[model samples]
Target: MGLGIRALIMVFMTIFTLTSVANAAEGTATFYTPPYVPSSCYGYQNNGVMIAAASDAIWGNRAACGRSYRVRCTGATNQGVPQPCKGTSVVVKIVDYCPAGCQGTIDLSQEAFSAIANPDAGKIKIEYTQV
Candidate 1:
């Protein structure tokens, strides 16, 4: 390929990398167990291990099906103080859809959730990256 063409490709690659890095998102996380809300949405249930769900209002549960995300808890905050995070990251595959009033970046299965935060927290601030 010509030098000019090579340079153009390099520039495009750089732009793509930057754009993906920009997509790293922040949100809240929670988990559910057993018969997931809307149990019919299972993608790869793994007999109920390492499964996840996202809000139907955002990506529609099936859209994220088969995709996994690396989730890390940022902290807990009921008011405005951000506490120390659990510093754990776990990969969970999308396998179902959470029902109404489910406000979170992703809804993880009990196993996946416990891998990151103490489930007793109910909800926690989180940052996740698709890997």
Candidate 2:
């Protein structure tokens, strides 16, 4: 191949690689919660913490909550895919606090928890990019 043509191809390849790297740096977080309020009064609402059990199949009975997270959703796993989280982004306020030894990352509300996790699965993977 001609020197000029080879040089042009190299330039284009470099640009494409750089752009992909930049996009991968972006990140988000997500969680799954119960669909409706539980019959038992075992839930709490702290200053920013919210915890509730799922009435549906996704997270039935098993407790899942969070203290703080960036994003939450109930969608397919996007582990390798870039920016998999999608749906309403809710701002959680810490009204109360969870005691020691809480299982999950954050104690989320019924609505917040349900967004990213299947009640049956009871757990959702979260991703975030540090600012």
Candidate 3:
């Protein structure tokens, strides 16, 4: 192929690769459970909530948990003194996922949980928005 043609092809290929990678990272988030005792034992009701998961490498694993773009959990503990019963919203990145059929709500690092709601509530509904 001519030099110019080859250069154009390379550029197109690069763009296509980047587009595919971006699309693969995109995902949708939704509510999983409600606040209750035995915080770790709960089931998600489909269509309960909707959130966004931006272009990230975290979604590559089905059993990853950590700081994600956002996390919505119902059974959050309020942080600090004077705890209250309130929902929790956290911005976390997924480091690993829960085991298959594992009970409890989405796991999050203590740091992420403190960012949105208190840590004393111990169990509250949560809704997070992707940033």
Best by TM-score: 1
Q: Residue 59 in model 3: shift from native, Å?
A: 7.8
Whole-model lDDT, candidate 1?
A: 0.74
Number of the top-ranking candidate, with lDDT as the measure: 1
Backbone atom clashes (below 3 Å) for every candidate? 0, 36, 28
- Error in Å for residue 113 of model 2: 0.9
Q: In model 3, how large is the Cα lDDT of residue 48?
A: 19
Error (Å) of candidate 3 at residue 41 is 23
Local distance difference test scores for all models: 0.74, 0.41, 0.40
**Every model's TM-score:** 0.69, 0.35, 0.34
TM-score of 2: 0.35
Of the candidates numbered 2 and 3, which has the greater TM-score value? 2
Candidates ranked by TM-score: 1, 2, 3
lDDT of 3 by residue, 1-131 (tens): 69999999999999998865454322223222322222221223221122222222343444232234555554333344353323554555443344444222444444454454454543444443334
